[model samples]
Target: ELKVEQNPLFLSMQEGKNYTIYCNYSTTSDRLYWYRQDPGKSLESLFVLLSNGAVKQEGRLMASLDTKARLSTLHITAAVHDLSATYFCAVDQETSGSRLTFGEGTQLTVNP
Candidate 1:
């Protein structure tokens, strides 16, 4: 069974600060993804990590994956109020085609 977990289930961050959300999984996976969601809205894809050491960044959000450890991270740089939202990491099992198991998610509130 594959299980995904994320730390800091709830985060309160001030604007202009940096933070990192950690994601860990129990099983081996080659693909990992990061997503963001706003209140009452669907998730938005932030990054797709396809292999070990794969990294992607956009604006204030950066994501990386390490398949060997079955771990991934989402790093926030200079977080702003607009970046406040819920973040999630999903892992794709090698045997499961297009099936992604999502983490509990980290709800971040960026205050001024």
Candidate 2:
């Protein structure tokens, strides 16, 4: 069984629209995180939620955590071409290095 799950593996958002990505986990343990990958680029760290009600945002991306419910959300406000990429939310397995268990990944495309 997978520890984490994300819906709408592919998200096509408009240039000036708002959308929210969802991340659900099986149990409570390590922290949850959000990351963005641009094309062939590496993962860009967005948010690291250690506990419930932890919210963070930068630019057009906002992320919130709900550790009690085992859920997280990444909200995108007013999408743009530069935001077109893949977003992935992962959860650590409470290990020494805190290895991540990632969702399938959401591919976002912002069309003009």
Candidate 3:
């Protein structure tokens, strides 16, 4: 079985500060994804790490994957209030038949 775990389930930080969210999986995975969800809205795809050592960045968020270590990281740089949201990391297991295992999600709050 594959399981994903994310640290700092809840986070509070001031605007302009930086933080990193970590995701660790129990098994090896070639694909990993980062997603963002607002209070009541659906999840929005932020980054996709398709291979080992893959990294992706957009705006103030960056994501990276290391298949060998079975870990992925989401880094937030100079966080803003608008960037406050629940972030989740998902891992794709080939044996799962298109099912992706998701982490519990990290709720981030940015205060000015």
lDDT of 1 by residue, 25-61 (tens): 9998878989899999999988989889998989988
Off by more than 4 A, model 2: none
Model 1 whole-model lDDT (C-alpha atoms): 0.92
RMSD of 1: 0.9
Root-mean-square deviation per candidate? 0.9, 1.3, 1.0
Q: Which lDDT tens digits does candidate 3 get at residues 1-112?
A: 8989999899999999999999999997878989999999999999889998898989999899889889899999999999989999999888657778999999999999
For residues 1-112, write the lDDT of model 2, one tens digit per residue.
Answer: 5488998899997899999999999977558889999888999998888878989989999999988888999999998889999999999876577678899999999999
Pairs clashing within candidate 2: none
Best by lDDT: 3
Pairs of residues at least 3 apart in sequence or in different chains that clash in candidate 3: none
Overlapping backbone residue pairs in candidate 3 total 0
TM-score of 1: 0.96
User: Candidate 2, after superposition: displacement of residue 61 in Å?
Assistant: 0.8
Candidate 2: minimum summed lDDT over ten consecutive residues — where?
A: 92-101
Off by over 4 Å in 1: 94-96
**lDDT: worst 10-residue window of model 3:** 91-100
